[model samples]
Target: MNEFQRISPQQAQALRQQGAVIVDIRDPQSFAAGHIQGSRHLDNHSLHDFIRNADLDAPLIVSCYHGNSSQGAAAYLVGQGFSQVYSLDGGFELWRATYPDDTAQSPAE
Candidate 1:
């Protein structure tokens, strides 16, 4: 596993307020169901394929369903020259559970 840094929900929320890009690194099918408002979707399963077609200059906040995939995404982003990159501390499940009213369930596949 990579030794990248993670940001807390509150910290993610704060950075989000400043226009950071929350990159939901789940499958497109999962993300289309539900996502943080304005989050960009890029499935972590194929980061190498999807990354080449992404906006790399923005502040990135990567997330998976439970924070696992995000570590890889963060590390990948760092390697691609992303200086301000972070993985959500607990992923989407935690985010939704923590902010119950703030988010909704993802669509079923």
Candidate 2:
């Protein structure tokens, strides 16, 4: 697709269960604190490797602090040849509130 779609937390959760690749674009500290389980922390340093190795046809979800930034990131991923790109509507804040149990924490790497 040439564009990305916006999805609610519920929709994102479903996609997650189905093995969608979820990437968080927040700062390292914030991302290390908590994020969707199995989500990868994508930053400038990792962007190139990520895009190079990702499965373009697989569903991909982009998330940011409150959702706004994710829209732009999602669009960029779509432009990079990701066929199914989605931006989380309410972002990490909503996901944390909606599915607290589905989140994970780790040291920033």
Give the clashing residue pairs of candidate 1, or none.
none
Q: TM-score, each model?
A: 0.77, 0.96
Cand. 2 TM to true fold: 0.96
lDDT per residue (tens digit) for residues 1-109 in model 1: 2235798878888888988878887887778766776676775456666567656666789988988889887897888877678899889888887776666445565
In order, candidate lDDTs are 0.77, 0.95
Model 1 TM-score, 2 decimals: 0.77
Which runs in model 2 stand beyond 4 Å of their true positions? none
The model with the greatest lDDT is: 2
lDDT of 2 by residue, 52-109 (tens): 9999999999999999999999999988999999999999999999999999999656
Quality of model 1 by C-alpha lDDT:
0.77
**Location of the lowest summed lDDT over 10 successive residues in candidate 2:** 100-109
